[model samples]
Target: MEPRLDLLSTRAGGDLFTMLVSANNALAASPLPRATQELVKIRASQINGCGFCVDMHTKEAAHAGESPVRLNLIAAWREATVFTGAERAALELVEQGTRLADAAGGVTDEAWADAAEHYDEEQLAALVCQIALINAFNRLSVIVKRPAGSYRPGRYA
Candidate 1:
């Protein structure tokens, strides 16, 4: 399959993609754990059905030493035994935040409180930004019908 738009080929699209990449780099410099950040990205990608992102993040996570078991279980994280409390909280936030149109109140207080229990303000900020960023990427990829299974770890880094 081919992408409907080559975002990197056109000047406007390339500029937009560059800005997103820059924002992602800034988020990467935040205090959130790398493993957790990958997991959050994967979960949001799954929710968004962005196969390109799911494939990208899973490979990136594995290259970063994330266990196959944990990566595979991320979609089932609510019942999986492979995550920490903070990771679970962040996952919940991912679900809530990604499915914003499905819920009346958006991210619930309970979920925010749970995330706060496990993360500092700085980490929470990172988590929120990462979730939003991944979702944006997902939407872009999905809208363009970006095909999956061609990504290599660090290709975009």
Candidate 2:
């Protein structure tokens, strides 16, 4: 399938896309663990039903050495025992943040507090950015009806 538009070819779209990619690259350089970053991206994509992003992040995470078991279990993270407490907290935040419209209070204070217990201020900032960025990507892909399962690791990087 084809994207409705080539986001990278149009001048305005390309500029905005490039800026977003640059922001993502900077976030990748943050102190947040690579595993955590991948997990958050995959989880948010799943929640948002952005198949292109799900395909992209899952492949990228695997290339970064994320295990199949953990990758497969991200959608059911609440019931999985493979994640650390910190990872769990982050997942909680991802769920709440991604489903903001479903919840009355946006991200709950409880979820934020839980994440704070596991991450420093810098790491939390990185996590927030990661969540927001993934959501934006998800919306763009879903709205454009981008097809999935053809992404290669590092293709965008």
Candidate 3:
């Protein structure tokens, strides 16, 4: 599949992609665990059908020492036993957050309370931001039909 546009060369007033990457980097430095961050991105990308993001994040996660079994089971996280309670909560939030129309009244209070139980206010804030950011990137990639599997780990860094 051919990408409709080259996101790298296209400028949106002021190098929009760069600014987006900068924002992503800020999240990277947040108190949120790196593994959790990658898991959130991967889950959101999977739901959004953003192959580019899936490829990017999965590779990054592996590079950072995430287990292959866990990565492979991310889509089936509900039934997977590899994730911790906190990770499960984040994944739950990602699914609800990304599939808002499918979720009844959006993320459930039960899910929110579960996530809040595992994550502190700051971590919750970061998790929310991470979910929103990945969704935005996923939409862009899906809309543009961005080709997948060519991303190198740390390419944006």
Candidate 4:
């Protein structure tokens, strides 16, 4: 299916997306592990129901050597035995951060504390930024009705 609007074709969208992509690339250089970054992006995209992002990140993660088992278990991460405690903490943070409207207060203290246990200040900052950036990308794609299933690894790069 064709997109309602081609985000890349417009001048404003091109500039905005360039900045967003740059920010995401910078976050990738953070101390947070690459696997953790992919998980965060996938989880946030899943929560936002952004098919384009789900396709993009899942493929990218796989291309980067993420095992299918862990990728498949991301939605059930809490009960999965494959993930480390730190990965679990990051997943929890992504969940709460993405579903902020469902919670009475934004990102509960418990989640933040749990994340703190796994990540240092700088890593936590990176995590938070990744969460926000992925959510932003998800919204933009979902709203624009970007079709899924055609993304190639490093297509954007």
Ranking, TM-score, top scorer first: 1, 4, 2, 3
Q: Which pairs of residues clash in candidate 2, taking residues 3 or more apart in a chain or in different chains?
A: none
How many steric clashes does model 1 contain? Answer: 0
Query: Once model 1 is optimally superposed onto the true structure by TM-score, how far is the C-alpha of residue 107 displaced, in angstroms?
Result: 0.4
lDDT of each: 0.94, 0.94, 0.94, 0.94
Off by over 4 Å in 2: none
Using Cα atoms with residue i matched to residue i, what is each candidate's TM-score against the true structure? 0.98, 0.97, 0.97, 0.98
| Model 4 per-residue lDDT tens digits across residues 77-119 | 9889999999999999999999999989989999999999999
Candidate 1, which segments miss by more than 4 Å at Cα? Answer: none
Q: Which is superior by lDDT, 2 or 4?
A: 4
Q: Considering summed lDDT, which 10 consecutive residues are worst modelled in model 2?
A: 1-10
Q: Which ten residues in a row have the lowest lDDT in candidate 3?
A: 5-14
lDDT of 1 at 102: 96
